[model samples]
Target: MNKFGVLSFLMALISVIVFLILRGPNVNLLLMAIILGSLSLLGIIFAVISKRWLSGIIGVLCNSVVLVSAYFTLLAYGIAG
Candidate 1:
């Protein structure tokens, strides 16, 4: 198992929870979520290439959820296109 991949996946999950909980006019949080989601995508790619299926799958799911939620949240706030 790739520890870095696992850690990245966990961080992605935490970011999602934070994003959902802190739903307000916080542009910083939205930016942070976007950064974390991108990093998580990299983590997923690396994990899969390294044969760390569990970490890769988790990262993919968490990152997808966070990115989608972040997009809608930003749209709702009129902060994104």
Candidate 2:
């Protein structure tokens, strides 16, 4: 995985943990899931950009992240469009 991506993952994890701690267990789980899901998107992006084993792993991670992030975005956006 790229250095920046790893850092981003770690940061996301830390932020989620902190948010959960402060926002209550229920909210934390929901938020963490969303964040991880979003970070996983990096994995897919990495896969397309890189051919290394690490890149493949990151791509998977990024895909998950993207899914969750997209979910949340849709949830927030609703069907307003």
Candidate 3:
């Protein structure tokens, strides 16, 4: 794999480890935010490194997921009320 792939793999691994370490009611949400944030950042990096536009499109999709998840979480906690 290339450098970007390696970095993405590392980012994914970090997210998993963080989730495992923070798997509790009081902190799972926070952990999720950190994971999604990292994923979004990595996606952007991947988008920047690719020669094709598809990679950038995927990055935008990943970012949207992160954003939607954040909004969903906020709504779950009645933060939007």
Candidate 4:
């Protein structure tokens, strides 16, 4: 198991969970979303560098989802604000 792969996966998983929790009530959190999105982007980079293919792919997919959701949140609040 590649260390970076596992790290990226955990980072993405935590970001997703935190996003769900924070956005559950549709909180207007542009800064928070941006921060999470950036963190997830880092995770994606780590995923790409990871040697374990399976974990790396999963990390990429999960981080991608978080990235999309973060941007969506940004769009929703940024325009509305």
In terms of TM-score, the best-performing candidate is 4
lDDT of 1 by residue, 1-81 (tens): 667676666667676666666556655655655665565566556556646667677666766776676666556546553
lDDT of 3: 0.57
The TM-score, computed over Cα atoms with residue i paired to residue i, of candidate 1 is 0.57
C-alpha RMSD between model 2 and the true structure: 6.1
Clash count list over all predictions: 0, 16, 0, 0
lDDT tens digits, residue span 1-81, model 2: 565545544544654554445454234444554555555554455455555566456545646555666476456445432
Q: In angstroms, how far off is 57's CA in candidate 2?
A: 5.8
Superpose all Cα atoms of candidate 4 onto the true structure and report the RMSD in Å to 1 decimal. Answer: 1.8
Clashing pairs in 4: none
Leading candidate by lDDT: 4
Give the per-residue lDDT of model 3 (tens digit) for 1-81: 456644544554554465477656675565466566667577557655754565455545555565566556545556523
Flag the better candidate by TM-score, 1 or 2: 1
In TM-score terms, candidate 2 sits at 0.35
The lDDT of model 1 is 0.63
Off by over 4 Å in 3: 28-31, 47-75, 78-81
Q: What local distance difference test score does each model get?
A: 0.63, 0.52, 0.57, 0.83
Error (Å) of candidate 3 at residue 66 is: 7.5
